[model samples]
Target: MVRNRELLSSGNAAFAGLASSFSELSETLDRLASVADDRTAARAAGLKARLEEFSAKITFVGQVKAGKSALTNILAATPGLLPSDVNPWTSVVTTVAINTKAPADVEGPTNTKARFTFFSRDEWDNLVVGGGRLGELAERSGAQEELADIQRQVQAMRDATKARLGRHFELLLGQNHSYGYVDPELVERYVCLGDDVTPGEGNPQTGRFADITKSAELFLDIPEYDVSLTLCDTPGVNDTFMMREQITLRSLRGSELCVVVLSAHQALSTVDMALMRIISNLENRQIILFVNRVDELQDPAGQIDEIRSGILATLKKFNIASDVGIVFGSAKWGEAALMGSYDGLSADSRKALEQFGAMHPELAGRDEWETAWNLSGLPGLLNAVAERVSEGAGKRLLERVRRNARNLTNEARATLMARRSGGAAVTVDFAGHSASSVMQQLAAKYESDVAEVCQQLRDDLMQRMQSAESGFVKRATDSLLEHLERHGESGTWQYDPTGLRVLQRAAYLSFARAMSAKLSKLYEDAARHVEAIYSAVLSEAEGEFRIEAPHAPRVPAPVGLGKTIALDLQSTWWRRWWQKRRGYEAFAKDYAHLIRAEANSITRDLEENQVASVLENARAILREFLKEHQETIRRITQPDADTAEDARKALGVLQAGTDTGAAFGEILRGLDDMAA
Candidate 1:
């Protein structure tokens, strides 16, 4: 019997190509490390090392019940994942992805307490059954319950399942993360990880299956494979109304490709027909159809042809010009083959199995099929997809790099715009910046925004702080006035809020400017971290992996953000405000100590003060116009924050670290002192 394994049972063609790509990337990084000017090669080597953590992304997604779990069980080539007893039937999306390995293993970002987490199998179950329970993170306390309780419930559900699924793969659930008490390891995965959806309660659910959510995406690592393809396993759209909504909201409109599956017993339904039309409407994405449960058909062979023709007719009805493939097989049958369960298997099921058998790159005529060790044809279909996606390699990577680079560049510009004491001609050298120097420069140039971002980050910490403060202030201010009113009413007593001393503490917390300044420093600290990432990118950019922009500097571009300047735009009201604020020098004296402290804070780590000095000057300017980014955003955002101070702080936490979403949330809670 062939022992099922992650790569062995299922023949993965993408594995070889992806592995080759990884090898090239690794070798290229190593080569740069060996000879590139300025240890860029070393930095690239480091990034490459980190990238290696994402070495094997094995996506296992399909429509409804396409035996994805069974396939995973077979491929994991292990027991207990999709045991035969609880096997093949999955309503939830499960992902067993990998976190970082080797060293500095900070892999638990998908746990509870994580503002951003992917769904685990159990979490997926809760979503599949409960719906919005997965997205409960944004709901208010309603009639007066602690929001934390809801979060805890979500986390607990996830944590319990994760403990059960303890594997190398990082369990990432998109769209649906709420629903459980996840562990610390899973919690940390979201620390600074950024997601496509801009945080808040995104895409909610309305029914019983409210908890059912998008699938979990896993990036796996096999020994020789380098660039791992992210594997995703989806829930049955037909089963849940809310899940269908979530899928439409998150993936449909933007999908570059989609694989549709129809069970043999359940041919396309009205709902399926409608979904087919929607997916077909997408001009950019291609949809591949799978005729699942083929083994269940009475005349499996004749039915396969009829099913193909039937699907073609159905596709025509939906105006989907592309012909869909009709694979007559079963995830259960495939599992049976992989597990060595043959004699009891039906003869027709075995024949249907052999048909799918012919599609597998590793199992064709291998005699393994006779003993039932062959994997599904799904791998072949997915590999075909990989080939299509990889055809134009550098183009996609370039776009991705450029986009990320531009975002970093834009923030850098925003931070530095304030420090222009005066300089002309782009003929100056920008090499030789030390790590400490870069940190200081980052802190110095964007200190105010950084501080604001930091303060905003204190949200969770600050919310309860502010919520408590809000309560105290309201009571104190109102009660104090009422006491004086009562004195008038009594005519015999002179009274004040000596009884409500708690208000005094509240009063102390009400100093907006002080809160602003404190948050400013916090933001600066956070920005320092963001700058570190940018600095890392730039430090690496000047050498081997250096991005060549559309202009002079070569940089990675995504979505084609160009130097006509988008993310890294050089001008914003914040910078202008900073210039005006500093030009006065009037408040400089009062702020002298704070400014110096901030400058010291910025300069502390730097070996040289000059680079820090230049950066500091920039920050001095941006601090004054702290409202710029926020002001514009508010016009576009719903339930907008009243002031830029809060927004800037929030932005700082997000931009400051690798886990942008989580950091934004964590930092937002931290600066609760500023909230209303």
Candidate 2:
């Protein structure tokens, strides 16, 4: 505020300059998209990259009273996320992301649990008393004390949820994390709690009648698309007092797609109007206008045309398109469960069929359902979101991206006035010994080995050098663990490093990072060496006739042949979550038993050290691969530096010291000194 005021009092140069630059940049972006200046060009490039990155984030939004949640469920072809008890359950604005992979792992701020962390119908009976842990423990144990014996109650509940917790879902553990929501930073912090948490009753403050804690977030790993989709199911808008302001309004800013759900009974309201205002800014975004709870207005025979016209007019006034995008659907995700259609509906089916269609015609039209029994009415909504997301966001990426980059030469004109207006200013002079010679020597050494390593890896690995997920998981976990130790109850607002445990004990995550970094480096070394060797060797063979370059005999074969890393060691969901359940348990038990039974098995096979044996096997594999592809080998040990530079330019390769992970880079810099 002070800065804003000062700028306001002075010539409106600061803000005005920004605004003017913004206008120019916007126009420049419309015409010329790239500039020569590093910072400006980088910002534009970065924004364009992000624009293409989140192209699949489809959001369902609306007012508190609007049936956004219901419509989201309807679009998803499910019973829906929150209860449809005419309440405000979307308090927190949950975002459900779904990927192509099987839905098994669920992450939260506090824990990373798998599918078992979720609950089954029968299992829920024993776990919950009141909605919250603080309340449930107090009510179930018959305690009326100032502070509920939280630890004891938590322990008991933990026992009840033992089989399910680590089995079903994974808990991420923290205040900022939510279930079903996975950020790259949070993946390492991901504590795999199972999915079997059995949901009983959650808070009924809002119209929330049911709890789908297990289904809180949906993460689908669609390998076919090489993409993951997360669908956030927001808490009811009516429940928490903190919700009245609206977070969807804030979060929907960069959304590529959104669904505004309105109830047929209440076509539009003040709350709905406020929501539209937020969405109005996103002209580039696509929204699915879903009218939910058509049951109340089932007699479309009487009000169908009127309701349609009302909706159409409202959309027109708001400049929203009117088409099949506006559909009447049910907010109920599991109507079959509520309607009792599971027992092969006969009598009830006959009586409620019309109401079912009237209430959820959207489901009836879906390919997943239309079985007359609504056993899978939910599939329609889920598929619709995916379909619409793909279709709606199908615009040309290069064209839609419009952040223009101005010519770097314009800097001269823009800043020319700075000298004339200011005339003279305070100046400082520094005289320090230059370390050019030392820098030259250091640069030479780095350019010799590290540079070679980087070039070799770049030619071979491209973007595969770092696993984005694994990298992010480690960083995010470390960050959150630091946050926890700094603020968690056990630490009691004090982050201490009094003894050996200080830095080492920041969070278990620190140790995890240490391990992860070590593994990454090891794997990186192997992959880089192997790839560099292969590419370098192969390229040497390809350019055998070129007399300009020549070096030592470099084997073109795969680095380590039969000697391969353990297949299970790769970053995988099975290793992360599945193994924890049936696979992990079986492997652990069987391995333990075998280790006990066959004392000589280790000596014979593993030496019998399993880990070491796996590495040896990997090496063998690489060796054999090289022997087979011997023609592809390059005999050159190290290519000439000058020629390598020229080749890099020809191949569009350049050493880009790009560090967008600002925080990560800072940590790396700090660690570099420690490493040295």
Top model by TM-score, which number?
A: 1
lDDT of 2: 0.35
lDDT of residue 521 for candidate 1 = 55
Q: Write the per-residue lDDT of candidate 2 for residues 1-676, one digit (tens) a residue.
A: 0111111112122223323433433444322223122333454555344443443566666555465554443323333333333333223344444333333334433333212123344334433333232333233323334124434454454554443334432232211223444432232122112233346753212211112232334343322232334454443333322232234533443355566667777766644554554443343225566666554553544565687788778666655566435555453323443333434334434344455556555656543224332422333444444455544442223222321111121211121111222222212121331222222333344334433433443333222212322333344345435654565422211111111111111222232233334333533443333333333222123211111110111111110111111111122322332233343334334333322222222112222222233334334433332332221121112223432342343223113543222322332233233223
* Model 2 TM-score on a 0 to 1 scale: 0.35
Worst 10-residue lDDT window, candidate 1: 556-565
Model 1 agreement with the true structure over 171-219: per-residue lDDT tens digits? 3434334422333233222211112234465321111121222333333
What local lDDT does model 1 show for residue 216? Answer: 34
lDDT, candidates in the order shown: 0.38, 0.35
- RMSD values for the candidates in order, in angstroms, are 24.0, 25.0
TM-score of candidate 1 versus the correct structure, residues matched by position: 0.42
